[model samples]
Target: LTVGPPPTPIPNPQVVATDFLEVNREELQRWVRGEPGAFDWSPFIQHVCKIEGRGEPWQEKERRLRGRLRRILPIDVHCADPLGAPLRPPADALLSTFCLEAVSPDRAAFGRALLNVGSMLRPGGHALLLGALGESFYLAGAARLPVVPLDEDDVRGALSDAGFTIRDFRSYAMPPALRTAVDDVQGVFFVHAQKPLEG
Candidate 1:
């Protein structure tokens, strides 16, 4: 929860896996660099304002960024509840990404979500995923959520259904304090995939 200077050795994949979410900022920046016309950062910019407790500036900036991104990229950026309701990816979207913190390890649900990712993204878009490593316990607010450990084969199957080729997939271990000998392996899955870019 505390954001400090990055640790040496990068703290392995588990300790710093949460850092993946923060990478969104860099991804957005990169998108803008490549296609400023398609860049829309209103959503994230608004979130930043909320963090700073500044409303007016946040609104103005959000509006402007949304306009800019919409102009350049034919993409729809939204804050969606994937579990509450089903959502589909854009057929024309060249790149799509998702980050799920609380997801049931149910195979059916996972399969559906992965299929949705493949269905929405056009050929040659990336999907980056971060899941709680191993079966671990964590408190959300006050309630504890137990993570169900996922192996590489399980992850690969889901990606295959989504018509994606796994470019990279790995398991990460959390800090020793979070680790447990048996159930609390404190591992997560990071997978990067891309749909075939058909010529």
Candidate 2:
């Protein structure tokens, strides 16, 4: 089952009403925000500072940016699978992208996981992702996960083998927490690939 605000948040995106799989709000928020994964650390750091100051109530205001991105792009969701395997969705599905993250510094596994996610999408579907390219740092719940950096070339090669056409592959910085200064992080590569309709 799949339903929520439409893939594209438009004039009247309505909350979908479906009864298939469970739609826990907590899980949805985690996926929407990419939590415990690619996230900002500034707020967390600030929160810790307050903890040290004791029981004083502090008003932390969240800013909501109002703007419009003038693009009618396809909406996508990525399931970080190691092997390029197909995932079955209900017929009413609206998402267009599935993905994996195989560019870990280990090189022990290539884009297998990411490829697995891509295999489930319909042809012409798109995806966006953050990959580690030549980066050697990461943190897992206070424990450090050793990472070795992989370059853009490596990412492309894996996606190609998984039957995806490279749409826009680039490098991007991980959230502050992923950086060594904030904690201990190494390096990473970013990519966006698609399954061609003509395939």
Candidate 3:
């Protein structure tokens, strides 16, 4: 978290985050500008610092993060250029958590979504993706959104086809106690992959 901002080695680093929905983008902007009704991310930051056993005060870390966040733009992961317009040169890395599967209706769409989002990064850039494996359909409020059931092989194949070289792939099974009828999420997968040097 203390690393310099992506694609930049300069001292004044900044983060450019994006969301597909205007509402979501606004929410982040609200938080970034400290508007009313903004969520407090202090506890989450504190927890992460505790886990990392870092000596730096969590408040200091939070300040650094807020300072780094300069923009919250809109993005469409299904589009060729997710950001729709040029913001800056390609980023060095991206981190996605439980997004592509939730937005995609099927396996093919999932792969396409990955490729689209990955396009935002420069060649040889890396990605840390955390997503579900097997057993689809997650409950968002009263709505049950369909998810493409994907296993280890499916993820590997999709990454391969997308031109990502998988550095590591880890899976964690759903514990019985946490499993519920609301969502049939069988397991979760975490992958650290890198694109080729030449785009």
Candidate 4:
């Protein structure tokens, strides 16, 4: 999902939501329409409320989120314009998870991909990125999908070179007990980085 860009210090703006997925998008629509057999987001809402610590009822939060979401679009990170049409004024923030590494063949490609995705986020806006660390491949059913093996330094340098200022960078090491032969992921990383404000 994305938030509209502004004249800086935009404390509030009309909240609209967008996500990438044709099938998932349809499923989300079904839920919004209160259709039976639609996937329920109750668990996720409850977890979010718990983490928010606001004691807000999950139903309220769910209703609020569902109401805000009006559009869902497919994303092609490699496209010069991810959404086909460039969003005017751009978006104030973008959230990406396990996307970069999956699409990139190597660190250089990863950097380029990040630059492409960052194009959507306006200056001074933040991008929250989550991805596996040092993972070369993963399984998609019987198919073994290949991915770029990334480390902390790679992500840090890419963000810097892409003109993003690192606000926070954290990594979680993979536990041996959970490590499987299907993938060689050593850990995972999360970064909150901001684009520089225009001069």
Candidate 5:
């Protein structure tokens, strides 16, 4: 879901809906225009679609994604304040990438954010999280943004405390060449977890 407000001011609720869609459409266009192999999002999208029993041809799927992106704006909810945003009923699954790590200043904050995210899920719901592991900072445009360095153990403990059961977890070490190219990120972690059904 695309949470938070649009880049520009929205005069009204209706305008908020429209502006959010426009902003997302522009961002998706920018991503699609990047060099080939710059981002391999298709496979991941396909996998999710397959699991949801909505798989389609690559071209069709891409078109659908573009169409959906242009029409949908999930500005109704924010991770830190899900209830305040009035996200009712909860979601069956959630996917977050590099968000909590970028915004959280420390391990405790990360854990809190994780709990907040878990609260958005229905019981037995799944979550896929990808974040930079052991990263203190990353460059954003011209400014350096602080990141909360978290390890596998920290993530596991946080998920468990958040009422989630670990289903899959993987980490990748930063390659020497890529390590110096951008930030001092030691590696990245990919985690798939589920909220306990009993809870």
Candidate 6:
């Protein structure tokens, strides 16, 4: 998606509702405030630019991202409890990264969470998920937090069970240098699944 500027209001422009959920709201707030060294998103933006063949400078991209963040207020923060407190008005698409695997203790919980998240989307809506694969635990500061080691099959099965059709999926093995840096994750996966249209 092109991250230039928010589109101007047109006569009946398509409305795409969105919401933010985080296990730790404070961390998200810190990142929004542009705190020093808070969640570096440059690498991700650069990667996308490379793939899309967009040669925009880093400064411009950062400016656009900051502008978008400025629109977020405290009221926008929502609890990460997928099965409990869900956002209103539902969403057309949901993007989650590195959160489900970190919080889900096992495969069952992961499936449950997937279903819960799917519930937040309207029929025919899409969900994009990215998470570490085959990772039992990851280091958080000085303590080790648990992660459910999941493979591609596990993810595909869970998504299917959660009433989603897998549209796109990919995986990448962790590099040797990065593998030993923090977590013992074997690989990472990116999945794009769509809910079935209403009959």
Q: Write the per-residue lDDT of candidate 1 for residues 32-54, one digit (tens) a residue.
A: 46555555656777788888885
Model 3 compared with the native: what TM-score?
Answer: 0.90
lDDT of 5 at 76: 21
The C-alpha lDDT values of all candidates are 0.52, 0.45, 0.86, 0.84, 0.71, 0.74
Instruction: Evaluate model 5: give its lDDT.
Output: 0.71
Clashing pairs in 1: 37-72, 38-72, 38-73, 39-69, 40-69, 89-120, 133-187, 133-188, 134-187
Against the correct fold, how does model 2 do in TM-score?
0.47
Candidate 5: segments with Cα more than 4 A from true spot: 1-57, 67-80
Cα RMSD, each candidate: 13.9, 12.1, 3.5, 4.3, 10.0, 5.8
Residues 1-199, candidate 5: write the lDDT tens digits: 3246765642321111111246654555554564454556778777777887855666676655545443233432225664445335566678888877787778887888888867767787789999988898888688988988989999998898888888889999988877774578998999999888873
Count backbone clashes in candidate 5: 0
Give the range where candidate 4 is weakest over 10 consecutive residues by summed lDDT: 10-19
Task: List candidate 6 segments past 4 Å from native.
Answer: 1-24, 30-40, 67-85, 175-177
**Candidate 3 lDDT, 1-199, residue by residue in tens:** 1255575565776788887889888888887887778988889999989999968899898889888898888888888778886547787788899888888888998899998888887888889999998868988799988888899898899899899999889999999999988889999999999988972
Please count the clashing residue pairs in each candidate, in the order shown: 9, 23, 0, 0, 0, 0
User: How well does candidate 3 score on lDDT at residue 85?
Assistant: 65
Estimate TM-scores for all models.
0.47, 0.47, 0.90, 0.86, 0.68, 0.72
User: Could you tell me which 10 consecutive residues in candidate 5 have the lowest summed lDDT?
Assistant: 11-20
Candidate 1, residue 104: Cα displacement in angstroms equals 2.3
Model 4 C-alpha RMSD vs. true structure (Å) is: 4.3
What lDDT tens digits, residue by residue, belong to model 6 across residues 15-94? Answer: 33233445345565566677996887779878877887778887686666665543222222123444355545566778
- Stretches of candidate 2 above 4 Å error? 1-105, 172-179, 182-188
Q: How close is candidate 4 to the true structure, as a TM-score?
A: 0.86
Tell me the tens digit of each residue's lDDT in model 2 across 80-190: 431223333311222221112322334435555455556545576665556555545545487655554566676777778778776666566556664554233334555
